[model samples]
Target chain A: MLDMPFIRIIEGLNHTLENVIAPEVESTLAKGQLFAVVEILKQISGRFDHKHELIVEDIQVSQQMLTTLIETFTAAAIDIPDEFQANTETIDATAMSGEQLRQQRDRLEIIVSAALDLLNSHRAEIVDAQKVEHTVFMQLGKNLFRNMLLVSQHRFDKISQLDKED
Target chain B: MALADNSRLASYLAEKLGGSELSISKEWQNTEGWSMETFSLDVEYTKGGNKIEQAIILRRQPVSGLLEPYDVSIEYRILSALQASKVIVPETFWYEADPAVLERPFYVMEKVPGDVHFVTQNSDPDYRLIADDDERASLAEDFIDNLVHIHQSDWKSLGLDFLGDPGPGKNSALQQIDYWSDVIERAGVRAKPLVTLAVNWLRTNAPETDQVRLVHGDYRTGNFIYQHSHITSILDWEMTHLGDPHEDLVYVLGALWRSPAPTDWVCHLLSEEDFLSKYEQRSGISVDRDKLNYFQLLLDLKAVGIMATAANAFAQNKTEDLKPAAFGSILDLAYAALAQHLNERLSSC
Candidate 1:
């Protein structure tokens, strides 16, 4: 959710190609090709947005984590702040737009993170602190696994064009 | 600004070498390095009525990328200090801080001749990075030896105190945590819950380092160069600093650099047990499993910082290079890896 938007990324690519790369290119054919690619990207920019379902799914996962956190706090007799509960209640995936859902998810993430910090600070006072911590870690692991499935394998070797001889 | 200007570079070299006529015969920027802008310059010049040819390397700071706010002079000084030591490094020539010259701070050094293996080179069925057994053994020996030498180096005698020692006890661990944590914050990324959890865990459980030595901030397989069966030089000292020697050991054992299943070799040269045994035997420092586990988590945290930094650079339109963009795109993968590691460690606890 913290990643740059697809439209902004496209804009960046076009800007780099036109401003940074085009003037340095010596061959007319290659320069034209670069511009063509820029044009193509511009044409496709309006049609792309981050997948809505992914953001919704991420929000759902975060809500599940907050629920578990609240349950743990209650079981331990630890006080849960009103703001934490308020943010958790605001996460209605059906009502929010994609960007709104993303922002809401990000807000919940910060609150949950603050809760974990508070939990660690007073770990001695809370019974079964380590067990609750384990549950949070497992939830995080599940979220990570879901996100990772969408990422394609990286070809870092091609990034630098080191394999090709000039 | 242009990445490199051959004519301007040749003129600068001519004045430095006391040569009247000098020219850059060939020059190529090495894009392989993600941090510094490295250019290999083939120079031909006349000095004292004699014609001389030299292969030189120029490392310039990028506008922005991974490990931002760079100062190439630190790396230059490190290489210069190691010239008389047992560590084999490229000989430093000169460092130029005047941005008018190359549009950025850069330094010149001797171009050490050898082939630097990239991870892509390991395409065999078993994913062996070094296909030749004898060659792998020889390179492995040099790799361990160079690391041991680096850790055993006398920083005070070498006048490398400019790198700043972290003093004694747990300062080394605390200093690194502060360093990477600051990097992530500066990148302007929302702190992920996993990163926050890891940072808290690291701060609470930092190990003590009794003896501090010069740690090669990046000691790994691809960072070294080899010719035939000998490792000619250790490259990429950008991250060099004074810290725990175990930091380097953990980096060498990072899963990202190791060969995949079937081969399962650390750095594609030796088994994990073999690497540890050799390092222990040579360095006379027993490996601490507890500290190693601590550093493994720290390493993952460091990766997240780096990836976030790269992504931030691109998001801000600070650099024209797409490589940083590509690196930033993989931030999720980094987070996932760190999250998975945190789960395993917490589960064991």
Candidate 2:
């Protein structure tokens, strides 16, 4: 957190981000955040078409371990748990000044734009490959994101009501 | 070759200019990807009583990267070789394979202009939309036509065979699998479940490709340049090797393509019929659904391996490295969903 360049991948972390985004460009950035969250689950459910089409061999291992090294894997964390510790500290969660936030968002925009380019290309690739129903999966991703926004809005709205009472 | 005020790199570029009075301007870390730092430099000088201004790209390998050797010399060789063969690539100016000057091998290349991204952040309509269906059909044909030119090109003839990694006994896929599996295994606790399953699948049902073809390992969107609906150049040949052409094909048109209309594939620009028709005409090969489907899975496997490896490096703290990190880490997640989809489609087998 102390580092000047410790940027988080706010979005564009996976193809799911691409799917969640493609149709909703006209939507508010607030809604974009919701779709971003739901995309994680949808991506989990998607698989590679040719799962076992390559081969790996190593004499040192003596056996085809066919396993991902545990140390390198990161478990997905999505519950938005009541409290959870970050691997590294998030010292300043407080909002930044408008200019600072815009700069951050501007950098993020570039990263996100690259992702959209990739997604557009990927959309073509999937369609060409005939991996899935084009509209079904991609639109499913978009619709799922829309629902995600609805759910997130509900949660925030309840919080707002409680705040008014306080 | 040298960026503004970075004395370390300035000295190195000075060596490449062959004693020319090299002054550097506009040097800044690209801060782009998670694999390597890309620096842009403006080299100004007089070559023959005429002033010359050249914009170049310098990629310095970080402490750790997803690709090995990270040799700019190799890239220079590969690009130069491809240029000779009618493939579009950034022109290589100078390369230093030696690790002395910059404490790492680095290369400088002339920067090619034009937008490489097909989609803008604004979701600017795909450039393919510039043409009507018939014209779009031709563009799609031109796209695959380039690919056929690539696969049919003689690797030995082009001098790129030596630029890649090959195993002692096994073919390219096995070598790649072995390499990536090792990466995953070395990742130890960080290995995702999907990768393990994908590896097993890759091991059991390998594609039966015998003849070797040059594979532009990451031949997909975000790796090519286009101008006015023309495919300008193919970029990011970092994972080049000898493998099955289907590997490149499936990768080029993998799940990367999604459509507003379910049937309108071809990355939402060209239709599948149009793209494949062009490929068949250019490549002179017939496709079998089963085999094609298998290669589709291989594309995902390769992509996921890359992401997993990148995430591992980032975890290890090579932050300056630019490439996708945790890029498709959810690929573990995607593979699971896509597996069920693939299995259903392959049920006849």
Question: What TM-score would each prediction reach against the true structure?
Answer: 0.94, 0.60
**Model 2 error, position B331 (Å):** 4.5
True contacts kept of each: 0.65, 0.00
Residue-pair clashes per prediction, in order, are 0, 51
Per-model CA lDDT versus the true structure: 0.83, 0.51
Candidate 1, which segments miss by more than 4 Å at Cα?
Answer: A24-29, A71-81, B1-5, B121-124
- Go through the candidates in order and give each one's DockQ: 0.63, 0.03
- TM-score winner: 1
Candidate 2, A38-73: lDDT as tens digits: 565456533312111111111111111111111111
Top-scoring candidate (DockQ): 1
lDDT of 1 by residue, B1-349 (tens): 3355667767889998788689888888887788889988888999999999999998998899988878888999999999978999988989999999878999999999988988653445566778789999999999999999999888889988899889999899999999999998888653567887888778877899999889888888889989989999999998888989999999999887788766667888888999999999999989999889888888888888888999889899899887888888888888887777777677777
Q: At residue A152, what lDDT does model 1 achieve? A: 82
Sequence-dependent TM-score of model 1: 0.94
Alpha-carbon RMSD of each model = 2.1, 16.5
Worst 10 residues of 2 chain A by lDDT: A53-62
Interface RMSD of 1: 1.8
Q: Can you write out model 2's per-residue Cα lDDT over B133-210, one digit (the tens) per residue?
A: 654454455567677878888888888779553633335567667766675555432133234334544554565665
